[model samples]
Target: MAFASYPSLRDKVVFVTGGASGIGATFVSEFHAQGSKVAFVDLSEDEGRALSGKLAGSWFRRCDVTDAFALQSAIRDAAEALGPITVLINNVANDTRHDAASVTPEQWRKALAVNLDPAMVASVAVYPMMKQAGGGSIVNVSSINAIWGPGHMPAYVAAKGAINSLSKGLGREWGPDRIRVNALSPGWVITPRQLELWLTPEAEAEWSKLVALKDRLMPEDIARMAMFLAADDSRMITGQNFIVDAGRL
Candidate 1:
C-alpha cells in the first residue's frame, strides 16, 4: 500500500533502537524513504550492517539496549553521525515468554531492563539534542499485551505498561521545550520472530477472530503511525497512546 509522504520529515534526523529487523527495521527504512537522515542500533551486527548498506547514508551501530551506558553512548554516536536526533523511536523490546512460577528475581529485572529501561534512558540522553534542535518527537513502541492483560510473560506486560506511563510523563515534562512524546501500541504484528516463535495456526485463527479488521497487522502498519507521530503532522499530539491494533482494544 502506498503511504502519504511528510514533507516535514525531509532531512530530519532520526534514531531508532533495534532497527536491524522486524518492526524497527521498517521504522528505519520508512524514515529514510521519507528523506530523513536515519541512524539505528541493534545487537544483530550482520543484519544491521546489511540494512545500513542497503540504505545509503544511514548509520548502524551494534548496541545492546539493556546496557544503559552503552545505549547512551550509541545515541551520542548516532547524533554525531547524523546530526542531533530530532526524531527518536524507542523500539527495542524482548517479549520472550516465561512461566511466572519459574521467573526468578534476575529474570524479572532482565525483562524490565530490556523492555522498559532503554526507552527512559534513551529519551533522557536525547533531550538536550532535541531541545537544541528547537523541537523533536519521541515515539515509544509499546504493545497491546499491556492493555489486554495477557497471561504469561508478566514481566513483559509490566514493562510495556511502564513504557506507556513513561511516555505520558515525558510528554508533559518536555512539552514546554517543544518536544513531543507518545506511545505507539501495536497488536499481533507478524514479524519474522513472531512467525518463528509464536504465530501458530491456532494462535493466528484465534487472533483473527478477535481483531475488528480481518487482516493481520504488519510492521509497515505500525511504522506508518510512527512516521506520523515523528512528523509535524502530529505537532499538537502528545502524552497519548496511539494503538494500531485493528481495533482489538
Candidate 2:
C-alpha cells in the first residue's frame, strides 16, 4: 500500500532511538522515504551501519539507551551531523519477559532504565533544539500492554504505563513551547525480534482471535502513525495515547 507523503517532513531532521531493527528501523526508512534527514542510534552496530549505508545521507551511531549520558550524547551528535532534530521518536525498548514473583530490585531498576528512562532523557536532550525550531513533535513508542496489564511481563507493563503518563506530563509542560508529546502504542507488531522470540503458529492464532484485525500488524503499519504524529498534520494533537492495535483496546 502506498502511504501518503508529508511535504513538511521533507528536509526535516528526524532522530530515532533503537533504529537498527524492528519498528524503529521502519521509522528510519519511512522517514527517509519522506525525504527527512534521518539520524538513528542503536546498540547493534553492524545493523545500524548497514541501514545507514542503505539510506544515503542518513546517520547512524551505536548507542545503549540505558546510559543516559550516552543517549544524550548520541542525540547531540546526531543533531550536529544532521541538523537540529525536529522529530524525535523514542523507539528504544526491551520488553523482556519474566515472572513477576521472581523480579528483584535490581531487575526492576534495569527494566525502567531500558524502557522508561530513555524517553525522558532523549526528550530532554532535544527540548532546546525543538524550542529553537519554533515547534517539533515527540512520539514516545509505548505499548498497549500499558493498559492490558498482561501479568507475565510486569516490569514491561509498568514501564510502558509510565510512558503514557510521561507523554501527557511532558506534553502539558512543553506544549507552550510548541513541542508536542504523544505516545504511539502498538499491539503485537510482528517484527524480526518477535518472529524469532515468540511468533509461533499457535501463538499467532491465539493473538489473531483476540484482535479485531485478523491480519498481521507489520512495522510499517505502526511507523505510518508515527509519521503523521511527527508531521504538521497533527499540529493540533498532543498529550494523547494513540493505539494502533487493531481494536485490541
lDDT of 1 by residue, 1-249 (tens): 667999999999999999999999999999999999999999999999999999989999999999999999999988887799999999999999888999999999999989999999999999999999899999999999989878888999999999999999999999999999999999999999999998999999998889899888999999999999999999999999999999783
Tens digits of per-residue lDDT for model 2 on 1-249? 667999999999999999999999999999999999999999999999999999999999899899999999999988998999999999999988999999999999999999999999999999999999998999999999999899779988999999999999999999999999999999999998998999999999899888898889999999999999999999999999999987773
lDDT (0 to 1) per candidate: 0.94, 0.95
TM-score: model 2 vs. ground truth:
0.98
What TM-score would every model get versus the actual structure? 0.98, 0.98
